[model samples]
Target: MLQLSCLCGQVRIALKQRPDFVNECNCTLCSKSGAHWSYFHPSDVEIEGETSQYSRQDKDDPAASVHFCPDCGSTTHFTLTESAISRFGNVQSGVNMLLADESDLAGVELRYPDGRAWFGETDFGYVREPRIIGQKDTQP
Candidate 1:
């Protein structure tokens, strides 16, 4: 079980199961935000205590909803709104990385080079390369 919480620990999020995919993005906000990414089904995650959501509907982002904690300013997750309309229900999978223990970080899924054109020196703060986690014995 992966338990995650807000910076102040006011809002708690508990994941009963591991996410199908752990992702990393070089997008402008994501890169600058400097947070790991994990995806989970809506039913797999549980939120305790009250939290606030901040987002504005945009025609460009027709199938997205951004949810976060207002108290600690933790960007929790974003859901796919379009899938819900097709019998998927409002609850959907999203990405959240507030867990204290990142031992289970699998790896980076993809890399967007020109994400918002915020390019410069590479800063891989969220990459989960097992080789650097003391698994150097495999090196040949």
Candidate 2:
């Protein structure tokens, strides 16, 4: 199990097991929040404390809602909205890796996904390639 908390400890998240991999996206909200995301079923996580929420419309539907610590303003986690839930089902949620200890992620892989391109209506003039985050540095 891994324990995750905001900078001020106002919000805490407990994960039953370490994630095998994490996804880093360049979407508008994700880029600003700087979250390294690991997915799990909501039931697999334990959240404690009060969190403020920020929701936004995407593709004409409420797409996502971000939950953050009111005191420290650190983003703890995010969940898809009803529109997304209807499409993807309530099967997974994202946990911010920045809130987790490094030891808890010792062997996990980091994946870079082109979420910006995938979700945006226009090209957004930025193209990203999917790759393992640290694979290049470790290569011979």
Candidate 3:
């Protein structure tokens, strides 16, 4: 299973299979927080730990939503819309798989996007090398 945890070891999550989408977004809030997201179906996820969800609402779009951990103020994941894709991405939380290690995370890759002009500069460094699989850091 795929597993993730938080910095403070408070929250955790597990996925039985690989997620369908994983990429970096440069929207206003995402750029400011600098988060790399891995999207998956909520049914494919098994979660544990305490995540105090901070939600926001807007009349213009009426459905944009994101979630951040209250403990570390870290952007964990978000829901694209409440109707479906309710679980868009799964951030690595503090709950780690008991026996999972390197071999299991081999195929997970990260992507950088050039979507918005206000994202500042998108630099993910040399990731094709062997030393680091992705950003080595999940932040933008």
Candidate 4:
């Protein structure tokens, strides 16, 4: 199992298996929160302890309820809101992979999604090609 926890160790998440890929989005919310999202059905993850949740006030109907550790202010995960579940069904929840040690995620693929241009009605464009977490340094 892959175990992740917030800075204060208050919120914990256990994943039964490694994620195939994780999205590193550039949207305002994701960028500001510093979350690299790995998605899975809620049933696949085990969450413990408590967290405070926030939904975007700007959107008339926010799609996700973002959770964080209240004590340390660490963005932990996000679950689809009731309205979103009604619209999209119980699809998946996003766990903040940033909470995990990079070494623990060394082999996972990281995808850069162009969330900045996504308007919520269409598919997301890629900002760049995906990269393996611990691949040889390709940058000079």
Per-model TM-score, in order, reads: 0.61, 0.81, 0.58, 0.95
Model 1, range 25-79, lDDT digits (tens) per residue?
Answer: 6564555445456666677888886666533443444455566677877766666
| Count of backbone clashes, every candidate in sequence | 0, 0, 7, 0
lDDT (tens digit, per residue) of candidate 2 on 18-119: 887877777777888768788899899999999998886544676678888999999899888888899989887889988987766766777666666674
lDDT of 3 by residue, 10-117 (tens): 656677786433455455555665565665656666766666653444234434355555686655555555543345443333122222354555555544444454
Which is superior by TM-score, 2 or 3?
Answer: 2
Q: Give the TM-score of candidate 1.
A: 0.61
Better of 2 and 3 by lDDT: 2
What order do candidates take by TM-score, descending?
4, 2, 1, 3
The residue pairs that clash in candidate 3, if any, are 4-93, 5-93, 5-94, 6-93, 6-94, 11-94, 12-95
lDDT, candidate 3, residue 14?
76
Candidate 2 is scored at a TM of 0.81
Largest lDDT belongs to which candidate? 4
Per-model RMSD to reference: 6.8, 3.8, 7.5, 1.2
Pairs that collide, model 2 = none
Q: Write the per-residue lDDT of candidate 4 for residues 1-140, one digit (tens) a residue.
A: 99999999999999998888999999999998889999999899999999999999989999999999999999999999999999989899999999999999998999999999999799999988888998875744
User: How accurate locally is residue 108 in candidate 4, as Cα lDDT from 0 to 100?
Assistant: 92
